[model samples]
Target: MFNERIHRLLKEISEAFADRRDPFNNEWLSKNDVSIDELHQLTGAVSSILDGFLAAPKETQVLLLSVGMAASSFRG
Candidate 1:
């Protein structure tokens, strides 16, 4: 279930990035200058990480989410 959800989220993010007419999208891509292939590779990496998490036990899954939350908070 988590794997599927993460895949969907990555797909949504990819679609948002690919749609060039979006103002924020344009500015973001312009600033970052990521190639299409690089973005595809990143999406693949995200899927692999999600797969690893899904294979872990339930307790570990919660721990992973907690770590991710902390990391995101730090980024902000």
Candidate 2:
């Protein structure tokens, strides 16, 4: 279940990049330092949250993942 979520998230992130209106102009991936792996985790956590897993103690875990994602997205 966890691995499935992770894979789904990665796909979404990759799709987000591919669907960008101006892929070349945005440079989101390069400027944000968003790695494929990090994107996978972020999307996974976000998916879990949307699926109602972001409750009580899980909220903290979700927040941490979000922070990690943000940091990694700008790791440079």
Candidate 3:
């Protein structure tokens, strides 16, 4: 489940990069000379860190999920 969550985040990041006209798209990253592979590398690091966060208390887990959802909504 944790890995899935990380994958979902990475997917969102990819979609954001692939689309430019979309309101929630990451135009800033695209405009600033960011690459899709760079985003993947960044998320890879994040996933590693989040792996430990996943082992925390239930409250922390809920917080992580909430943050993830918020980010998704922002992406949309």
Candidate 4:
């Protein structure tokens, strides 16, 4: 049973990185000093935040966009 569990876990991990050309691949992580787990967590957080933004009322979205634009302009 333990060996079967290990095999399944390995398979899942292998499938997770099946796309080598993706920026989230091992090479990119190594170059950026990031771990795969950390990348996964950040990706999840960003996805959740974006989902909230998308589901928000249109006026709220517009206000957020305006604020974001203002912030970007101040960076220059």
Candidate 5:
């Protein structure tokens, strides 16, 4: 997920999971110093960005999603 297209969007999630926290569980994040409110805000921003991307031409969206994506996301 360090594709630079989305700026390593899943890196933080990977980190939480590697640290033995449930990234999908808000309770885990809340109890582990991650603010749910901030997560919500960041999600909102991502949603907006995706919406804008969708509004672009089909070629643009295709290029953005396909180019420079998925260089590496796993290290085990």
Candidate 6:
């Protein structure tokens, strides 16, 4: 069970680029004198993610919006 949990955590961290360090932490990026061009493979990542979401089917898009609304409701 512990190994399984560690595997899942590692997978999540990898997906979020936790191994890269600078992308998620502003202070680290600034401290290291990182410019926009040197963002370690994150230059077009947002555009790609947004494009993929936009390219998803309309039904899938509606489901995504609904999920967002449900999450927002919980934040209130």
Q: Worst 10-residue stretch by lDDT in candidate 6?
A: 5-14
Question: For residues 1-76, could you state the per-residue lDDT of candidate 3 as single tens digits?
Answer: 3455446555655465446434234774555445677567666666676787877899988898788678667766
Q: Against the correct fold, how does model 1 do in TM-score?
A: 0.55
Off by over 4 Å in 2: 1-26, 53-76
Which digits, one per residue and each the tens of the lDDT, describe model 4 over residues 1-76? 2245334433333344443345456765576566566566556654676898899999999998897667556644
Q: For candidate 2, what's the RMSD? A: 9.4
- True-vs-predicted CA distance for residue 66, candidate 6, Å: 0.5
**Backbone clashes (count) for model 4:** 0
- For candidate 3, list the clashing residue pairs, or say none: none
Give per-residue CA lDDT, model 2, range 1-76, as digits (tens): 4566455545455456545543223374566566677666675665675565355477777786787578557643
Candidate 3 Cα lDDT to native: 0.61
Q: For candidate 6, write residues 1-76 as lDDT tens digits.
A: 2245334433333344534443447774565455565453344544565697799999998998787667556644
Candidate 6 has what TM-score?
A: 0.40
**Superposed Cα deviation of residue 9, candidate 3 (Å):** 11
Please give the TM-score that candidate 3 achieves against the real structure: 0.39
Candidate 4: residue 14 Cα off by (Å): 29
TM-score of each: 0.55, 0.34, 0.39, 0.57, 0.50, 0.40
Could you list the CA RMSD of all candidates, in the order they appear? 9.4, 9.4, 9.4, 12.8, 6.7, 9.3
List where candidate 3 sits over 4 angstroms from the true fold: 1-47
lDDT of 2 at 76: 37
Q: Write the per-residue lDDT of candidate 1 for residues 1-76, one digit (tens) a residue.
A: 3455445445445455445334236565455565676556656766787899999999999999898667555643
Better of 2 and 6 by TM-score: 6
> Which regions of candidate 1 fall more than 4 Å away from where they truly are?
1-27
Q: State which candidate, 1 or 2, has the greater lDDT.
A: 1
User: Model 1: which residue pairs collide?
Assistant: none
Model with the higher TM-score, candidate 4 or 5 = 4
